[model samples]
Target: MTDFIKKLEKEFDTQIIRSNKHIWENYYDVDNDGNITTLYLDEIDLRDIDILLPIAHSLVNLAVLDCNIRTLITLKSFTRLEVLSLRQNNLYGSPLEHLSYLKKLKKLDLRGTNLTDTSSLGTLNSLEMLFIGGNDHLDEIKGLEDLKSLYHLDVSNSCINSIENICANENIRILNLKGTNLKKITHLEKFPNLESLNLDGTLVEKIEGLETSKNLKELFISTWRIKRIEGLENLTKLEVLDLYLNEISKIEGLDNLTNLKWLSLNSNKIAKVENLENLTNLELLLLEANEPITYFDTAFFHNLVSECYIYMRDMIDIEEIQAAAPKNVKINYDDDYRWPTSLYRAPREVFE
Candidate 1:
């Protein structure tokens, strides 16, 4: 055995396997005092690490760190970290001051950390994805204007009322502000590359200020107080739209979205399914949990092409509608077989 391997075993107080038998075996090293440190560790699983041990500062190549602990004071030295997850930690009162020096960070997950202020994260210019959701007390994110390279940002279930700080980032594509106190949104024209936006469970009463986001493809505004479906005629590139659990009594302003594929207006006050004949690309239409439909429009069913799935309430006469509908359009009334209740359900590839 080499003298360096002996010293590592003595420092880490563990047996040393010097041979590079596995791909991951060569990246880890143990110190003489049972402290693991490595220069080649790209991803570190700190979930099972002893909290008493000093954080490994020597892992210069560490790219990912999964540390969901009570405090992250020791992680300030990980200057080369690209992805740092402090999810579900008991953090409080702006603990991100410790991570202000990590300039190369691209992804940071602080979900469920109970963080109050995130002013310290604005300096991370290279961040691409940031997940700060589930921090119920986090009301402000005013310092995120400098993140010019950000792409995806999720602040769901936070107390934020406005998103004016990061709206100017043209590189951002997906923005999630669900379960927030947002009432109005402006400066959407600055995000010319934004494709997917989520405002579910927010307090937004109007759907204006999005006339310039023509690049938007997927939009979710479920469980809000929006009564009308106007102000969306400019989104010709939209493919998936979810307005479930709203106060919409009629369906309108969707004729421009010729590329719409998946649309959900479930749990609303809609009584008619009109204005959908122009949606030639629609495949899945969800209208479940709405007022009972006493009037049947067979022409509406004929507008949908073959293999289209329409999910509605069980009270609708399926046999009568099927007799008049096209042979290929599948009308489903089974509540159990319908799409998942949540509009923001993860993509199907997550389980596969």
Candidate 2:
């Protein structure tokens, strides 16, 4: 072992292995008595440290790597790293230049980093999960089309204006594009394996692009400019649907989703719960902060099963509605508080 690596081992209280012939090919601490599982180094400014090449080469078998180092210049040696997190760093240059070499990386989190270009990430074919949110300068995600193994991708709160490059990766299951400038999603039919999609806080005025997404289970289009619920009749396998904070005045075109469990239409202009009679599998329904439901129908409660709970505005009489509801169903009325109360009267045997 060299004198520099020997000093670092004693300083960090960890073992460092060094090769005499191949000095660059060395490993970190091995499992002695089950003391080390991963190498976690966060909030450390690596710019002041000089011998970073030896320290980077030592993390060969590292499974979980978390480093907030100011400069990511020496991360090329961590080839065996599986999970890497470099969030909240001061990386201004091309920090992702060496990450493409980590072939075993599965989860990567670069949230709040200064990355503007992501062209090097296309080489990481084994990456399954990636989070690049809060990057204000990232206006385009152009090089992620080859990530066929990716399943979950969160690019929320970024400046992504177009997603034309992301339509080719059909294996993605969960895609979150909240708080972007996406006005239209043109390629919904390409992702047949997509299960969950979030387009909240975008400029989407219509719901028109989902024609072949029959396997989708969860969808969130809240805070959009949609006034009607159209183009969702093909998603028969949907379970959770969130259309909150929109201009939807009616709840229509959801009768096909019989497997739906949770439906949120709160903070809309809906005046009644009319078309939800077929959602017998629905467990939770949120309709609070909307127009007052003037007509209370007992048939709505009769269609829902005993485990179903409906949350509505506080203007309705809870006791009167509970008397008319089915024996198994529960109705919770909001208390008009700033934080809405969950006060409801259910049979004591239901909780027991």
Candidate 3:
């Protein structure tokens, strides 16, 4: 390691001299030239931020999570930082414009912070993925239109009431609005490149405004007020569809979803499983907790899961459903498993 890193470690060694604290080497990632590339410190009360000035010039990723940090003025020295995560901090009154100097930053994760303003984000022109979820005080986001290159945006579990300002992010590919104040789904045509959309834990009743999301692949809307399955005829590229814990009665309007791979409709009011014979690519099907479902299309299971696997965890009537399932289809069960979006899905490939 370089002398600067040695001095940096020495300072950290003196600062956190307790036996329970780890050394500075364990909290940083170094390159071949002995330059610290990434530094991660969690749950450590960072009273002095100047201790990290030694490696700031070479650091590319920095995470000071849950450290009770109250300012961002010291991070301006990390000129090469590309990814920064200040999750679970107390930056309620910090100056967000100080981060605009990070010209190389691409992804910024600020989840579970007390930030209330985002008007200075427009200056970070290189940002591609912005995560500001779990900020209950952040009711609105500004400068979304200035983020021309932004493709992934997550504002779940916030106090935002409308999407009028969000409609300007025309390049967003994956938009997550779960557990927000959105009452209805609208302006979907504004995002022609949207792929994955989540509206779980909202008050949306009707499944409209999605006629133009033709390239959408994964859609999640659970535990809401949807009663019927409609407005899904144009999504030919759809692969995974989850609509659990709703009030859906009958299964219909799914003729164009021939490429569907996974379908989840648990805890609904459906009486029969029909109209799924065309989903030949389906590998996993979930129909648990639907108390009214009595009839199961044997032909659909014979053609769909006969050559694949399925998850039958906590199924309503496992014995009967297993009896009706094909013998070649393997059924796996889990007692306490939940979907990734139960809270909010991180920015990753949902299918894999």
TM-score of each: 0.76, 0.79, 0.85
lDDT of 2 at 286: 83
What are the Cα lDDT values of the candidates? 0.70, 0.69, 0.76
Q: Write the per-residue lDDT of candidate 2 for residues 73-110, one digit (tens) a residue.
A: 55766666676666666566756677877888877877
Highest lDDT among the candidates is held by which one? 3
Which is better, 1 or 3, measured by lDDT? 3
Per-residue lDDT for 173-269 in model 1, tens only?
9888888888887778767888999999888887888888999999999855889998998999998899988899888998888899889988888
Stretch of 10 with least lDDT, candidate 2: 343-352
- Identify the runs in model 3 with alpha carbons over 4 angstroms from their true place: 1-26, 302-306, 313-328, 332-345, 348-352
- Number of backbone collisions per candidate: 7, 0, 0
